[model samples]
Target: MASSAQPYHFGFKKSKNGELPSIAQEGFMNILQKNGSIFLGDAGQKELYLTFDNGYENGYTAKVLDVLKAKKVPAAFFVTGHFVRDQPELLRRMNDEGHIIGNHSWSHPDMTSLTPEQIRTELDKVREASARITGQQKMSFVRPPRGIFSSRVLETCKQLGYTNVFWSAAYRDWETDRQQGAGYAYQQVMSQLHPGAVILLHSVSKDNAEALSSIIDDARKQGYTFKSLDELKVKMYR
Candidate 1:
């Protein structure tokens, strides 16, 4: 999108002469510009955007798909080249079922640590694979691996015609052993949810698959409808 009309504002540490410290000024500006709010369409409308990352063919994806299909809900799936190549059918199913498929980089490297060329390669590899499998060029959304991104990464995504999507809400269900439980994860997600909240879940989590439908149900009960990132016309901060 559109750039947010909201003015950039932040608290800053001042120097002895009352001027802002250089580092603090830069940090504050970055925060203010990068921290745009996620809008879920109209005001007073409770909408939740569900997104999944690092999808591989664990067969749990199918179960997750089943639940979404049953509920007539759509979600966004960020896939790597490896997953797309290994599970072409599942990728196809995701596309065919009307879910948004997004790039999550080829090897899920920490983009901030990679060279600009390496980052481009990571994005290009995933874009090429996703296009090959889905016959669609120009995937418009991406989430950095581990939610790590630099200014260079964000600029790279913009140059590649992809929007960098990050979540407003997430939990520790990515770790299989540390997942607390499905019910608890579900409760954590739903409880913290708000309008325009992008809830990040991992497709690889067994607890997540178990909690998926219930989370959707409970979010609905609380009057939050779900939307894909593509459907959300959020103002870009940078």
Candidate 2:
């Protein structure tokens, strides 16, 4: 594999009317496919994967967990070292409730700029800390900070025994201060709903916390089943 130091920002054309989103960068898509990374699941199936980036505590993860528990939905939470240190109890709750704990690096740095060994250290620190807290010895999934990655970054992670998980559906919900409302979050997510969407949400968003239950309900009403990333069946685009 070629070690291209260039960073690729993950983005896709928003899906509408249940259409599959398209990635604009062919080279980046190739890198993802070659590395066995995934941003979507089987497009032919009406299944959605929910994941959250927990970079820090925003006082809403508990609510999120509550909703997931009530709705019986499984989600993956990618946590950074800061999150692991700051919210051990929350990590334990997530683990205890049968959710997937994924690595989001130690310091949440642009991993494309780091050396392979440096990346290993960053990921290892998070995994080790999380394992101590959650008693899960293996952390198999990773999402690069800020959706930025390179072939070298992905390759390094692959060699380290991780699957890079990206997102096929997302919105600007991370800006907590600018939260529109729960309705806004619901609209943004529902409008982009499609089969095989790997929806990326931020646990810091109050709107997401409020709208999550409704999102799950409406997605289910639309005949879409919620699935964990572990059950994902990859479908590559041309």
TM-score of each model, paired residue for residue: 0.81, 0.97
Model 1 worst lDDT run, 10 consecutive residues: 14-23
Note each model's CA RMSD in angstroms.
Answer: 8.4, 1.4
Q: What does the lDDT read for residue 157 in candidate 2?
A: 96
Stretches > 4 Å off in candidate 2: 1-3
lDDT tens readout by residue for model 1, 59-89 = 5899999999999999999998779889988
Q: Candidate 1 clash total?
A: 0
Predicted structure with the largest TM-score when compared to the true one: 2
How big is the positional error of residue 78 in model 2, measured in Å on the Cα after superposition?
0.4
TM-score between candidate 2 and the true structure: 0.97
Query: What is the C-alpha local distance difference test score of each model?
Result: 0.71, 0.93
Candidate 2, residue 66: the lDDT equals 99
Provide the global lDDT of candidate 1 against the true structure. 0.71
lDDT for model 2: 0.93
